[model samples]
Target: MSWKLQSVYMGMTDVATHNVLLLLKSVMRQCANIELNEGGNLLQHSLWVAYQAQAAGCESPLVVAALFHDIGHCLCAGDPELPDYYRDREHAALAATWLSRWFPASVCAPVAMHIDAKRYLATVDPAYRMQLGRGSKQSLENQGGLMTEHELSAFSSHRQHEQALLVRVFDDAPYVGECLPPYTRYERIVRSVMR
Candidate 1:
């Protein structure tokens, strides 16, 4: 199915929250079969990340960013034109572009920078690169391996750099079999912060 995000968000001034939630629920349900690392399926990983964000005492926007950070994977999976590696290299941009319509830069900026955050961490923390999952390791190669000193310096200057790094921590953590609340647990939190 062609997912027209604009159509989904159109003409609802005050109800962007509800509409965005519905859009997220629809995507999650439709993409339930897609695996996201050994951590689990897409929904499971998102929930775990979001749970970690909340547990870390993140504000609502950061929690939402964690929940939706990898949504571009699902979007790319549905597209026949995009290659697999494109999903890895471009998913963050895809998700951030779509989410920018409804969320402030505080939320979307970190989502956009998540892939770079991984690369940054890999460069700064040698052990971080070793701990990556098979998929992430492969994607790291596609995402330009480790960041160069110049790239690292530029990425560090972004206002949301710290938030992006925090999200990256949750992204790399193994969530499967760990105790995490159900996806439903964050519905209210997501709704409250939407738009």
Candidate 2:
């Protein structure tokens, strides 16, 4: 038998817990059909990012943000074939806005600026671009083809710049081809930070 969110919900009766459960289920369902070009689906990549965040000693909210940072992709059509401009900013923006319903700025802010962080790294650290896969490079173009010097300076001043950069750093790490810790493992972290 496989682990399931519904199975974990049987004994839970709190309204907030119920809501989170529903959200998790919806995310799982939505991500099931969306496949990434590199391999794996959105949910797996999400879990991996969260796992990396935790391992990197990121604060709880940042870890949660990592888990769902790309959730906007799941929330929308997420079609890679759409056009150059539709690559990821829309998804990042959507995720930040959607996550704001339950999470604080600590969470939403990072999700919102993660793309900018990527652009910052790619432009500021010349060798950084080499680490990205073909898919990420194409997506970066859709995200405005790297940041200008002024954009990087402005982005650095944003209150959550470091947090977003941390999220992006973990997100950019190579996937290890594993299932990741189960969602239930992070429920406490999620509930503790909910608004």
Candidate 3:
């Protein structure tokens, strides 16, 4: 049951939920082959984040956001024509845009803002910048360095700001060690959140 975005956008609501879930599974499987800088693949990273969110008592939307936050990395990496910096900066927004059609703003907004949340954390917490992995540090630079005070203030006003920060925290912690339920364990949880 592979799904394409074109078919999804063509009023295929009847199967959209199932198809979207299938697409997520497909992407997670694809992530196994793509190495992340944190010493694991995107699938592991996503699962780690999802598990951390659930452990923290985050709501379903936030957990879903955590799982899919880095999916943009897989999506953007597929385009050979795009530069690395473009891929780094655009992945979050790309994931968010695609997700918005199927998910509520609660889910999509954090996915969209997670990158900014990274930048925001760097601004507010001096120790946070040093905690970023090598790739994340590079992407942080590519993402306009740390957010300025004004930018941070504006970002804080978003309704999902706290959830975005929590997702960011989970995103940062996965590099420490392999932990929690396996990747497949999240399939049911993710599917439950699909509209």
Candidate 4:
């Protein structure tokens, strides 16, 4: 692993937090080279959700969470196989943990629990399940289907539960967005939030 990443895993110094304004610029720059299946763009999707959070006046941390929520996809990029991320339920956790190195739990927790938020929504809202795209559906199956009673109860009481659910709402948005402004636009937010 790269020294930076290894340091992070070893609980070294890192910071991962910021606001929506900078989100637009940073995400555009960050995601410019990123793309996903179909016509989806990872940064586009992330920015869309982050923008939504911003438009709704969500907290800066949540906006940042929305912006990098699926970073795991990039982290696991180029795997010829399905990757072991799913077998261990590490998809969101991977992103969250990595971000945790640089960010506080306020930001990482929502990213970490986004998938569980999906499962939570599917279990509580039948229409939500029906609306899930094929990929999401497959992932849900891979994520152990709907939340069991115990899982649901535990999730509902989580410290970041509300924020995580909000992140999911943004995550489900269609993958389409314009390039962000500029990284400097919100650099202060990131600097202030970093550990």
The lDDT of each candidate is: 0.84, 0.84, 0.84, 0.75
Residue 124, model 3, lDDT: 87
User: Of 1 and 4, which scores higher on TM-score?
Assistant: 1
RMSD of each: 6.4, 7.1, 5.6, 7.6
Across 1-195, the per-residue lDDT of candidate 4 in tens digits comes to 998889886563232233443443543565556666546567666667777887799988887888778877666555557654463266688788877877899999999999899999999999999999887788888877899999999999999999999999887877454565433544555566666
Q: Pull out the clashing pairs in model 4.
A: 14-101, 14-102, 15-102, 16-102, 16-103, 24-180
Task: Show pairs that collide, candidate 2.
Answer: none
- Worst lDDT 10-window in candidate 2: 1-10
Taking all chains together, the TM-score of candidate 3 against the true structure is 0.87
lDDT of 1 by residue, 77-186 (tens): 87788887888899999999988887788789989999999999999998988888787799999988998889999999988999999999998887557687777777
Find the candidate with the highest TM-score and give its number: 1
Residue 149, model 4: lDDT of 96
Better of 3 and 4 by TM-score: 3
Q: Positional deviation of 116 in candidate 2, in angstroms?
A: 0.5
* C-alpha TM-score for every candidate: 0.87, 0.85, 0.87, 0.76
Candidate 2 at residue 154, lDDT?
92
Ranked candidates, highest TM-score first:
1, 3, 2, 4
